[model samples]
Target: MQNSSPPKMNATEQAYHGIRNDILTGRLKEGERLTETRLSDDLGLSRTPIREAIGRLILEGFIERQSGYTTRVAHFPEDEAEQVYEIRRLVECYSVQRAARLATEEDIAALRRIHAAMQADTPPRDQAAYQRLTEANEEFHRTIVAAARSPRLTALMTTALDVSMVVRTYSMFSEKDLRRSLNHHAELIDAIEARAPDWAASVMSAHLLAGAARVAARLKTAGSDDGQD
Candidate 1:
């Protein structure tokens, strides 16, 4: 009998995903310095694969070049984060509207499953739990974008949604924020299932804006505290 299992990741894939996971799980953290030697040693791989992984991550906005042959995990400033969310709002709102009009039963079912997984992970107890929740959340949004059936928009979403800084923002959600977010997802599912484009768009706009507001408020508070210190 043939084995039924996923293929093992190659060295480069291992390095890439290992580093990315560390960043997303908050082990590496924003602005933390990184080096090829350190990563290669840590991953038990040669410099070649680690270097390639670092290059890909840098292009993907997970890592940033620093002064003279150094790099650090990318940090999104408040304005940059606001801009990213604004772009997401514009893109995702339109996508969800189209999805409402065009989504198939399979698409809706997939969304429901993702949403259920998200609900199950709610009030993420630890950093690892939060990481899983964040992944489910990402998949939920991506599934909606795919349901729009626009290849061009999906490609754009791939880039915008891949930002590590944005992924990390899920860890910022408070209990109230988490509940409100789940409610938004439920409303969105209803709107899509009802085939009401306007309703879906309205709910999505509210959802994205509410999240942006929460992040903005938190950033402002952090800046104030830093100033006081």
Candidate 2:
């Protein structure tokens, strides 16, 4: 039998995951400056791997290359942030419908496992707990996209997903919002299992729209506060 273990990451991959985890956990805050030398020292890796990791991150929309050969954690303006969700709606809503029709038993099983993980006994009480939930949530969505069996759609969603990570959409959630989101995921699974494309698409549409509205409202509130300041 072939080895079932996952492959160990190489140095560059290590750097990439390290940096991405920091960004996702807010250890590397949005718009925070980065330099290869600093990151090399911080991650205890050499500059070559750090440079390679940064390049990949920039391509994946996790880091932005600014003027003067500098880079920072990616941050979007309000308009672009809104556009991110619009694009997600366009991409993911369709993907979910395709998944409903195309997903195999194994694919559906993976999604259910992710959903069950998210539906832990208690709510996320701290940053670490929330991080686990967020990662699980991301996995749930990515699995659906994978089940859609479209590489082009996956590529299209790459940047949108990264931007959503940067925005930390779940941070804006209330207890009620969290419950509603869990329900949406459950409904999505049911639709996909039933092979109901229309139902799956409808649930995905509502899910994405609700998330977009939350992000937009938060952005508006932040903008208002900034103006006052």
Best by lDDT: 1
lDDT of each: 0.87, 0.84
Each prediction's TM-score versus the true structure = 0.80, 0.74
Candidate 1, residue 89: the lDDT equals 91
Model 2 weakest lDDT span, ten residues long: 163-172
For residues 183-220, write the lDDT of model 2, one tens digit per residue: 99999999999999999999998998998888788778
Q: Please give, for residues 102-180, the per-residue lDDT of candidate 1 as tens digits.
A: 9999999998998898888788887557767888888889999999999999999987786575676666678899889
Top of the candidates by TM-score: 1
Question: Any idea what lDDT model 2 has?
Answer: 0.84
TM-score of candidate 2 on Cα atoms, chains taken together? 0.74
